[model samples]
Target: MEDFALEHINDSRRTILITAQLADSWNDRIKEIAPDFTIELRPWAKAADIPDELWENVEILFTLGAFPTPEQAPNLRWVQLYSAGANQAFTGPLAKSNAIITTASGVHAVNIAEYVLTTMLTWFHRYHQFGSWKQEGHWPDEHGRDLFMPEELRGKTLNVVGYGSIGREVARLAKSFGMRIIAMEQRPDHRDRGFLFPDIGDPEGKLPDHYYTKDQFQQALAESDVVVAAVPLTPDTRGMFDATAFHAMKESALFINIARGDVCKEPDLIKALKEKEIAGAALDVFADEPLPDSSPFFGLPNVIMSPHISGMTPHYNDRVAMIFTENLRRYLKGEPLYNTVNKERGY
Candidate 1:
């Protein structure tokens, strides 16, 4: 269910502060949605650039990074984040605010889920290893011809480590490829809870053949031919996938992480890769972005590393705007908002 725990606050003349590069069309759309409310589109470089007088009148704020001090925007009660992850939203001044925070959780779900499938297929066929053959201008003879044989995705089991919006989409795509889906969910969800993209994800949560809780974490890991980590980074989730979790997987299993880097222990993962504890890993998010030059992940032949960008697409901002507009309608009607962030849960 959507979060309705937040109480409604009303003002005769409300002001919405937006500090992102929004389109003229979107601004006009917001104006059309809330005709009486004063909307300010100040895509400023810093909070100081925004007039203090304007800050005092702000009731709602939409941003990716910009946040106001408690004293700066006393009237600010709602925050609409521009990204799927709520981790960054929980940091800085906004974390302490009583604002009813919402995220663009379903916006990036489609793109990130596609990234998961791409990596899975790439690893399964050992496509990256073919680069050496290409550079050498040599084709493997009959004896080594098996190296070029493609691995079929049919009938393979996929373990969705965290079954949120992104994982749901991943399962939907993998299902079409005839793969079995198992999900490790934090809660008992027979149906999807919040912010589903229009007919895109596993809305009924029926894709996964089996659902396991945190208590069955190791069992969940062992049941996969391919494991996709789509979990959020919370206090309970940080460093959750260490040696034991890796050890639980089948030796030939492929591990894929589109989630936050800290979710896996870097050294343990490297050790697992070195020992062939699991066949390989496809990592998008890293504990440290740009993945330092000294990092061992670069040298590991079995690891596929990308610069933490699994959730990007040309239409990204447009989808995020959709979520914001929907929430705005709900805000005006004093209804529950989608993708509402729970501070205690740290999603």
Candidate 2:
């Protein structure tokens, strides 16, 4: 097989579809990399809104949110997603399609990891308690100290479930606080997975004191002060944190879910919190978006919730562009793309 590369593009201009409106500067950047390619901009308002003819000849696609089937785009060869977690897009009929799929996996690691550390610090320092005191216009300095003593992250065991890009970033930050790390991953033996992003995550697999596989989930849960959920939402991970899983954790352990909400069953989490099975929880993503007004999580004093925006960053689009542009070059040459998804595993 002649390995694909830029030379294979030939003189004919190839069609590339971008489903989002980008600055004109990006056009120049793409041209600089592959001058023979022609770009088509189509902001993804609705998938069905796109004309049938537009999908007929698109060879490559850059999309933030939209999945067209192989039948819809006969000429489509590759898809570079603007978001992390392929989820529904990677599964279903598309999984069997000829088109290759890639995700923006490591792009959110830096921001999401920072959010995790911020929540941890806030919990440790009892910042929420201080806010309450301020609201009540009461200041009992010594009484406050006695009521809510501050704890240090140092020397604490931080367990990171799903040691992928996000988990690795959490471990990297946790290490800076002098915390001991124990992470669980699907493949513990293949510890060093390369990433496209720079200055993020534990590439060397040196941060965690030990790494465990699925069989040791209970053991990992039992030996930590803080447990961070960074796994994707897959069949195996759905409702993974059930009653039995909650019972395996230390009573004083703090739980943080930066991963999908379905990973932890809502009922099990509620029961654990109400019964004090664990100390506290900080959640970024949930089973349902815009968590309903009637949800009990809103009233939990020990819980902190964000509207699934932990990964938001000003440079998000720029980073996505970089990943897509790099992969586009690889695609032209017929080389392996970065962040290529494993549809079977659902990462």
Tens-digit per-residue lDDT, 1-347, candidate 1: 45565454476667988887777898899999988789988774467788888888888888887788889888888889887889866788887888788988888788999999899888888797798788889878899988878788989999998888999999999999999999987676567777777889888888899998889989888878999888899998999989999999999999899999999998999999999999999999889987899999999989888998888799987888888998999888888898888888887
Angstrom error at residue 200, model 1 = 0.6
lDDT comparing candidate 2 with the true structure: 0.81
Which ranges of candidate 2 are over 4 A from the true structure? 1-13, 91-96, 188-194
Candidate with the greatest TM-score versus the true structure:
1
Q: In candidate 2, what are the lDDT values of residues 1-347, reduced to their tens digit?
A: 11233333342546788886666787678878777777878877455766777777677888876667778877777777888888856566467666777788888888999999999999998886788778889876785566568999999999999888888989999999999999886664635453447777877677889888888999889998999998888888999988998899999989999988899999999999989999899998888888998899998988988899999999888877878888777776667778777766666
Estimate TM-scores for all models: 0.96, 0.93
Total backbone collisions for each predicted model? 0, 2
lDDT of each: 0.86, 0.81
Off by over 4 Å in 1: 2-13
Backbone clash pairs for candidate 2 read 4-333, 5-333
